[model samples]
Every structure is written in structure tokens, then in C-alpha cells.
Target: MTDARDPIVRIEGVTKAFGSFTALHEMNLSIASGEFVTFLGPSGCGKSTTLRILGGFETPNTGRVILDGQDVTALPPNKRNVNMVFQDYALFPNMTVRRNIAFGLELKGMGKAAIAARISELASFLELTAYLDRRPDQLSGGQRQRVALARALAPDPALLLLDEPLGALDAKLRGQVQVELKAIQRRTNKTFFFVTHDQEEALTMSDRIVVMNKGRIEQDGTPEDLYFRPASRFVAEFIGETNLLTGQAIGRDQDVTGFDWQGNRLRAIASPGVGATATTASLRPERVQVAQERPGTDNAVQGRVVNRLFKGHRMLLDVAVGNTVIQAYTDTDRGRAIEDGPVWLGWNANSLTLLAD
Candidate 1:
């Protein structure tokens, strides 16, 4: 959450190129104070490049980097009021956790009593009171991560930059820390610029997510918006599991669109600027309903059950509709209707979305 005050950071018309390869193309972004924004994309998608440019680690070829209304594009990393937490949690193995957290405060010429007080505050806040005397090598991976985060926060920078800080932990630990990090951000009310290739992580922690592909931004929206209403094929495919149906447009009626897919006439909700000739539709598995008889719905098709994957409470079924396979999910007990034979799949027209790509 953030106040209505102006954005704390802004990147305008930024582009970065190395030799013949372009990393970022006309990157533009604005982040308000206390807003947890995530830069999510695959490798070489310019997410990290954008982060480095904002943190003053790399200079942008053309554009302005404004931090709290002051341009800092040409300033060095240390000169800017920003701190980055590296993926490896670059902590000093030889120093105790208290000393490590106090390193930045010491560099800023803080008094002994003030530095000690600040260390005490961070130690209690990060739940590292008992481990204050332990070195980085003596602490657990999660503790080391917290120590690194505490050290970065000790400086009290205007913005915090995190580059996949949780990549080193195990799956369970990573999931647990994601919640903790989000809680910390809300409590501290500090603007965070995080970069990661993990979709689930981005969805779990961000107030807003910027989806990037190749060398540009694809979509910027809330987690639910990007997951439920993707703007392009790349965003629809990258955000989560989806079934893409490609066909020619048959007709359009306001929001609903009729299309021909593998000789079957299906209808879906069309996006803005969807052409009348050919297009693609995206459908989520959980929205597809499979039954023994065709339900009276706007869209229905017959298919043979080819595969079923059970996951305790729910199950995923792969129904072969002619040559194309459409996947659906149902409750374990309700899934018995399409065990292994021909079945009818039906879904509301509003559930399916016509993609721009």
C-alpha cells in the first residue's frame, strides 16, 4: 500500500544495448512509495537490466532515472540512495551478524550508541536476537538471508533492490520466506524493486507485477489481472497453465465471439481489437466443466477422455476432441463421469478469453 503522493522512482525512455544485442527497449516505469513491485520475466528479458539501471549499477544509453524527483542516472551505485541485495546474500562470513548489520551504518559515520541502537532494532525486527553474535557461516541459510536483508535495510536507503534473494533456499523455505518478505515490506512501508524469473513468487508477493518478454514489457497489472485477463499470448502462456485454442473467427456479438476450432463451433469473450478473420483463445483448466451429457451452455464439445491425473482433492483430465486435446479439472468425486470414455465439455462463454495474439 502507498500514499497518493507522487511516485518515488521513475524510469523514462530508457534503453540499454550491448554490442549488437539490445537488452532493454524504451523502458518506462513508475513506482510509488511503499508499493511492492516485481519485475518478472525469463532470462534475457531485460528485467535485471532494468533493475541495474535503476540501482545505478549500469547506465542507460538514453533516458532518465529519477529517484524521489532527482535524476541519478549518471551517479554511481554508492552515490545514489539505493542498496541492492545480491542473489548470494553477500554477507561477510568473518563478521558477526551484529557487525555485518552495522557495517553500512558505520560507513555513514553514525555514533557508536546510535549504531548499536539501530542494530538492536533490526535484530529484534528480523528475529535475529539470539544469532546476533553468530557469523554468516554459523547461521542457517534463512538466517543468512535475513541478515543480508537486515544489513541492506540498516542503511535506510530511499529504495531497496532485490535480485532473486530467495533463489538459494529450498522450495519449502522459499515459500515460507515469500510470506515473511511481503509482511516485512508492509510493516516497513519501503518501496521495493525485486527481480525474479519465478512466476509464483511474483504473484505471491507483488502488489503489481510487470511482465517482460524478449526486450520489452508485455503487461503491467495486479496478480489477478495478469492471471485471469492476459493481454497477449506470451503473457497468457507465461503467467500460468492455459489451453490455447487457435481458430478462425466466425462472428462477433458485442463481447462474445464465435470461432471455429478443429471443426467445432465454440464461443468465448473477445478482447479489444480482436480481428474478424483469425485469432487465438485462452482457457484455464479449472474453468472447463466435463460431464457425461452436454450441459445447456453457450459452448460445448465432445471429446474422449485420454488421461487423468489425480491430486488428492482435485484431478486434471485430458479429453481428446478430435486431434486436439483439451484439459479440464474437476472434483475427485465429480470426475468419475469422464473416467475413460467419450464425454462432453462445456464452459460459459465468459470463462474463455480471446487473446490479442
Candidate 2:
């Protein structure tokens, strides 16, 4: 088992470029021995590039990659104790399930008994003992993914890198395999660095997440921290569905500020460094509460319901305030059932977050 006290991988000031187009900037990060960290972002955002560098598939133009306290920046793929599970599963067409799982051991020149023992251990963990002789073509999508995972684990690498491992599976199969993947990770306790563009998958599987944008690290924290407290405008909008109300800053103090959205004035309880200029109020749709009549509060706005959508147990309302629209989620049985009429929207003072211009 890997030591839990030490960081298994340390990447410092890593930069990669292809001609004039830079894929990764001088990014610095650390992954603990058994920690499951995910790199989340949109396409061409350098998340895959960073993973490639860590796997020794691509060399960085600047800075160093330190694995297990040793600088392995110049090491080739064969020398590094890291294995990757590709998006396609990348199983050999002619190889049976047993051969695919034992291929890595054969490359390392292990005895037949040793290879068999390792494959048996992995098959039991992944519940693939019955399908040991089946080929990739004969197994289902979920079974193929498990075989890929078992192959990666057969070599016992210090770190396992997954590059969109579930992208090929259908929605229902993805959910089922996701549970299996998490269970396997917990049982092995191997450091995992997963790269994916799916936010829901990242939030559900990762212990911590690193959000990237334009080849730069936007934010890095626990899933709860990123969901609740985003560091920038891009992060707040990218991480989840949020209601962003842009307005001119009308009032300010050391600890509080106010902004004007349309003709409506709203109070903001935000950081002490919030400036008086063009700022935004970020709130989740679920945080917004709707009332038939205006509530007597410091932050309430009068608007008309333009449209309503029934989303099973809850309802979504698009409240129109002059030209601006805000989305609010209301329970099916809660407060006034919204019709195409005038209504009031109320959000708590603390929920209004004043973001940088």
C-alpha cells in the first residue's frame, strides 16, 4: 500500500506548448498518495494536457514533474510508475480478457504463476472472474470498462490516471459504473487523477476538484467549496446553474455594498474587498423564493412571471424584471402557484454575493 503521509505526485510550474499555442501554463499542483483529485473544465482548457504530462506522454516545456519526491520530469513513459485508463478502453482486439489483464505483467517479465495470481486478485475485486476468457467484443460496455480498470491495476502503479473513462458508456450504464469505480477507488486507496468535462461526474466522484479555464487554474478546492463559493465570474457560471444579475454598484462600505438591477435596488453581503462599479449578484435558482405579494424586507423585487416549467416534484419559474430575467425553483406544494401574472421575488441578504467586475 502507498504511504498516506506523503504526496505521491508533485507538479510545479509545468508548462507545455505546441508552437505558438500553449496548452498548459506554469501550473503547480500536488496530489496526495491516496487522494482522488479531478481536473474539470471545458474542451481545449488544458486539463487533458496536464494529465498527459503527468503520465509522461507529453513533456513540459518548462518546470518539473516530481513523483514520490523524485524529479521525473525527464523520465520516459516506461520509467514512470503511472498508468493511464484511456477514454476508449484501448483493449487489444485479439486479446482475451485474461490476456488483456495479464498483458502488463508480461511486459514486466513476471512468472506465469505471479501473473495469474495478480489477475485473480483484480478479477475478484472487479467481479470479472466469470468473464475471464471473453473478448472485448463479447462483453458489455460496463464489463469492458471494468476490464480496462483491472488492467491498469494489474501493474500496481503508484498513480492511476483516467481520461474520460466513462464517455463511451450510455447514461444508465454510466451511472452504474460510476458506483463501481468509486467503490474500487476506495478499496485500493491509490492516488487517482481523473480528467473530465462533465461537472456532475466530477462533483460526484472527486474528493477535491481543480477547475481550469484557458490553460489556467481557475479554482481548486473541495466540491462543496466550489459549488458554494466560486472565486471568479467564470467559475460561478461554469460550475453549476446560477442566476447572475448584472448591475451597477450604487452603494458601498467596508463590509457591505448595494447594486441596482434595473430600477430595483438590492443589498449585498459580500467580501470586504468588493468595489463600487459594475458587479454581479450570484445566487442559485434553488435559493430564490417566490411570493404572490411583495414581502416587507430590505431585499425584495417586484416582477412578473413570464413562464413556468413543471420539473416533476418542483417547478421552475422565469421571473421577468423589466428586461432582465431570473430563474427560481419552487416546490410543487409551496407558496403561490405561479401564473402568467405579477409576482414578487425574495432572496435572503446573505445569499446575494457581490462578485468582481
The candidate maximizing lDDT is 1
The parts of candidate 2 lying over 4 Å away from their true place are: 248-260, 263-278, 293-298, 333-336
Question: In candidate 2, residue 153 scores what lDDT?
Answer: 92
TM-score of predicted model 1?
0.94
Q: How many clashes does each candidate structure show, in the order listed?
A: 0, 0
Candidate maximizing TM-score = 1
Compared with the true structure, model 2 gives a TM-score of: 0.91
TM for every model, in the order presented, reads: 0.94, 0.91
C-alpha lDDT values of all predictions? 0.89, 0.87
Tens digits of per-residue lDDT, candidate 1, 1-357, equal: 225377999899999999999999998889888889999999999999998998888998899999987899999988888998899999988999999999999989999999999999989999999999999999888889899989999989889999999999999999999999999899888889999999999999999999999889898999988887777889889988899888878898877788888988888877655577647888889989898888887899999998999889998999998878999999988876556998999988877777876
lDDT, model 1: 0.89
lDDT for position 326 in model 1 = 92
- lDDT by residue (220-268, candidate 2, tens digit) is 9999877766666787888888988888778776555777888778877
